[model samples]
Target: MTSVLDAKTLRKEAAEARQMADAISNQQDKDFWLGIAEGWLELAQAWRSGGAPRSTKLKEDSAIGSLCLGT
Candidate 1:
């Protein structure tokens, strides 16, 4: 739950950074801001799936079955 909230916040920050980057005149500064935006967006995407049972699903989908879990 917290992760999902944080991810939303991060994505908002990324949008702000992108806007700032677009407003800047200096190429270097623009690039830096864009980079920050990209980083934030990536982190947000990672966090957005926080509640997913990814590991368990992967284990279940494995062809090697319980061997993947050392069972």
Candidate 2:
């Protein structure tokens, strides 16, 4: 399925990822979540600035797909 996310939604997801990272005890897991949050925030900023490319079908193995799918 194709999903088009707005900047607001992306920022919300970023915040949620950051909160999850804060609750993690493992350094590796925390870092992973923080990275995801950063990616989401960047994407949101790009969207707000109209620099983000149009949404396309994401491969299941892609990093962005994993982030968006919460896999």
Candidate 3:
């Protein structure tokens, strides 16, 4: 179940990642953290929309039925 609180947390993490990226001087480290920030932003957006049922998580006792296991 995706909640507003979960989206808020993701936004906070994204902000922290962006701050860390800004503080770093190394290009590789900056890119990595920036990527993390982007990922968190995407997740937050998804959660805010409808991420829980959209996620590709199988219920207990449910078996994988296809190779293209995407939501």
Candidate 4:
């Protein structure tokens, strides 16, 4: 049977998966990281639609991070 994930668990899993991606050195690793990021974004969106409050600071910080990455 498939398991269900609560928001907090999903968040933790997503972060851990991302860390794994970072510790690798190959195209496959980068793709894995992208997948983790997508999963987190999906979960975060669902949480928002489910009436959870958004973290404005998170968005602001991430935007700055993206700028630094130049991606």
Candidate 5:
């Protein structure tokens, strides 16, 4: 239950970071927010999987990755 709550909180934070990225006019600033969002999402996934977060490598096909890569 606590883990579920933690994952939810992390997901919420990820959403907020994405929103911040959306509001940024500078590409670098937007990328920074997107990176933060990616980290939060990775943390949420790790919490759900009962493990520590790993791998900062961005998924080439992910939405965040697409944005970060400008694809």
Candidate 6:
């Protein structure tokens, strides 16, 4: 299991994640979001499942697959 980050480390992670998210051009900008999906996947997984996903290898390894199977 992943170790929980301390408040400072978690804050740093959150800031970086927010920076990446703020760089998104639009809601439909796949490449931008996908670029940082690792962070998103981790945070979301924790919120829902109480832990990080094993990885953010992009379950579908293609843009087309992603478009057809977005969350």
lDDT minimum window of 10 residues, candidate 6: 62-71
Candidate 6 or 3, higher lDDT: 3
Cα deviation of 49, candidate 1, in Å: 2.9
Residue 64 lDDT, candidate 4, scale 0-100: 23
Residue 41 error, candidate 1, Å: 0.3
On TM-score, the leading prediction is 5
Cα deviation at 26, candidate 2, in Å, is 0.2
- Candidate 1 per-residue lDDT, tens place, 1-71, comes to 24445877878877998999999999998987786676666656667766532333224343222322565
Tens digit of per-residue lDDT, candidate 4, span 1-71: 12765677667666776787788789776775756555565556667579533433234245322432464
| TM match of model 5 to true structure | 0.70
Candidate 5 global CA lDDT score: 0.79
Q: Please list the C-alpha lDDT of all candidates, in the order they appear.
A: 0.64, 0.75, 0.65, 0.58, 0.79, 0.51
List, residue by residue over 1-71, the lDDT tens digit for candidate 2.
Answer: 12778888888888999999999999998987887777777778788988953444233564566755677
RMSD of each: 12.3, 5.1, 9.3, 9.0, 8.5, 8.4
Residue-level lDDT tens digits of model 5 in 1-70: 2345588888998999999999999999999899879877987898899996685555666555565468
| 41 Cα displacement, candidate 5 (Å) | 0.2
Query: Which candidate has the highest lDDT of all?
Result: 5
Give model 6's TM-score versus the native structure: 0.34
- Residue 51 shift from truth in candidate 6, angstroms: 14
- Number of clashing residue pairs, candidate 4: 0
Q: Residues 1-71, candidate 3, lDDT per residue (tens digit)?
A: 24455788878977998999999999998987886676667667777888643333333332211211342
TM per model?
Answer: 0.60, 0.70, 0.64, 0.50, 0.70, 0.34
Residues 1-71, model 6: lDDT tens digits: 23764444544554565576677767666455454544444545555666644555545764323642583
Better of 2 and 4 by lDDT: 2
